[model samples]
Target: MKKWFLISTIVLLMIINTNPASAISNAPIHWGFTKGKNEQQAEAGKAYDELLRKHHAFYKGDPNKKVLYLTFDNGYENGYTPKVLDVLKKEKVPAIFFVTGHYLTSEPKLVQRMVNEGHLIGNHSWSHPDLTQVSNEKLKEELKKVKDETARITKQKEMHYLRPPRGILSERTMQLANEEGYTHVLWSLAFKDWLVDQQKGWKYSYDNIMAQVHPGAVLLLHTVSKDNADALEKVIKDLKARGYTFKRIDKFK
Candidate 1:
């Protein structure tokens, strides 16, 4: 009887030791930007693509296609989204707007316009906290509140895409979010469009965007930038000239 009890305890310990849940690491991820069209950049992009593929997350579109997926991060209303929406409407381009709690509560009208205009609205968390630092319960609450509220207001039930705040994500957080039925969306190309005070003029915006235009690019533009608003129309036209087509994120993969 004593031997049987000891053997049972040893087996239980082995099972606990090998449990997958116990192996989850909560380390933070430092996202690095892939810069310039060099071999190094290409390799980095490929590695990133593999990482996303492993976790079923997305940072860019299909590399074999001449398609661009456009997304905007809307943390707050800076009085530039309406103009951005107008340009999108005029261009007949579809985009995804990742909105935080503040944007949803303060700019319901704009949110409604986005849905009505056939643009996709994604969850950008409730308070824009670094999800990696939050507890799993808080993470679920953050995502759920925004999703519930957005659905309540927009009458749209599908809001499965999640863009981590400030573009920071960890392996554990990504897995947690995926378990909640969200596909994490990052960006292949993003500039300093979010810094309002560091505006480099519309020309700088135009050149920066145009120079990096590539196939299967997931382009992130902050809706709060005046320079982005000013250069949006011309950028779209230029992209068309280069034979690139705009695709919605849902259809990107």
Candidate 2:
């Protein structure tokens, strides 16, 4: 009986020890704080520069008229994502999730749930690295990594939107992403919402988010915020009441 108990314990330990770190491959992006400057890199990538101009022209400087797009960046899953999803589900609003490679691999079910529920999934790079700092080759690889992983796991066509890590953009990063079939995305408003170490309560963040909302606002939220989860549904309801309808990014020129 003692031997059987030890064997069972060992088996359980083994199961826990060998689980995948990401739903995908093991890479350095999995183990580092994604830090960097991207606007400088765009100057270097002529193609990236063109992409910026293209999208700017596409919108014709009128993105804030009777439409709103809500995008969440998924660098790491929060304990709150499930609840956030619950709120979104309850409200019947479809939003976009710009996911990193780790999010694709660590939360495969969430990826599937995003697609199954008709929300768009855009690429946020493989490891959330600042694209402008890496070489063009590396940037392309990063772009492909997230796009491929998310599509492969979810069995969906790769979406065309790509949000830069830390909102950093470069000519090179933009060019590479565009060449690879993505339009660079940046938010009009984002605060210190990504730091999982700090616990700013929802009431504070909610007021901040509400204060920032405008016509055709593309609000940025992170998956790792308790305040975000708490504020999400309430914000959605409050925004809807105030005549803001949520939609995926509808213009990509």
Candidate 3:
């Protein structure tokens, strides 16, 4: 009986040791953080900072440089992206747009325009599902579909960044994304500008950004917000006057 019990324990240990899934946590994390104020850097807390660091994810760049990275989450178009693009073009600033599969299929022209305008198209998953619930195979399928379709439409050879759907992530998800050659790009500055119905005015968007602006900030904006569209050019001008240089995601260091 003792021999049998020892054998069972050894089998259990072997199973635990061999299974990588058993060692990694898939707990869903709805990304949130302490917002920066007065040019102070935002903090994602010690635990989250360590988690991102472990998987080579980035929320902001070097804190000493007066640099800004503009990123947009394009889950679905609401007709304001063209205005946002116009502002970027006029200001000579670079930005990245994390797009969904729906966006890819429905707005291929805009996707091509994004590539043509020298902006990046990042993966926001094929269906915008909570990635923590997906299997390894499903996750790979999701990422590949976006990359493949974006390449097909835009003729852009490589895609390299991902923003987990609904601002959700986990260690397992980040690891899976990194394994598939994509880095997680979270933001250091954002606000409630995504609610199309609740927009106060262009000033509302501009104020939130200026209040949170800091060295090495990654600003996440939604192209669907009309206020953001109206406020973008002024925001760019003001930020430039403040000595902040806009940069692309690939240039982060």
Candidate with the greatest TM-score versus the true structure? 3
State the lDDT of candidate 2 residue by residue for 192-244, as single tens digits. Answer: 78877786788867887776565655567887988898888888888888776
Stronger candidate by TM-score (1 vs 2): 1
Collision pairs in model 3? none
Per-residue accuracy of model 3 over 46-114 as CA lDDT, tens digit each: 999899999999898888999999999999999999999998999999999999999999999999999
- TM-scores for all predictions: 0.91, 0.74, 0.94
lDDT of each: 0.85, 0.69, 0.94
Give the CA lDDT, 0 to 100, for residue 169 in model 2. 63
Superposition error at 150 for model 2 (Å): 1.4
Model 1 per-residue lDDT tens digits across residues 24-82: 76677656556434211212466656767777987766667778889999999889999
Q: What is the full ranking by TM-score, best candidate first?
A: 3, 1, 2
* TM-score of candidate 1 against the unseen true structure: 0.91
In order of listing, the candidates' clash counts read 0, 13, 0
Off by over 4 Å in 2: 1-51, 55-64, 251-253
Off by over 4 Å in 1: 1-20, 36-47
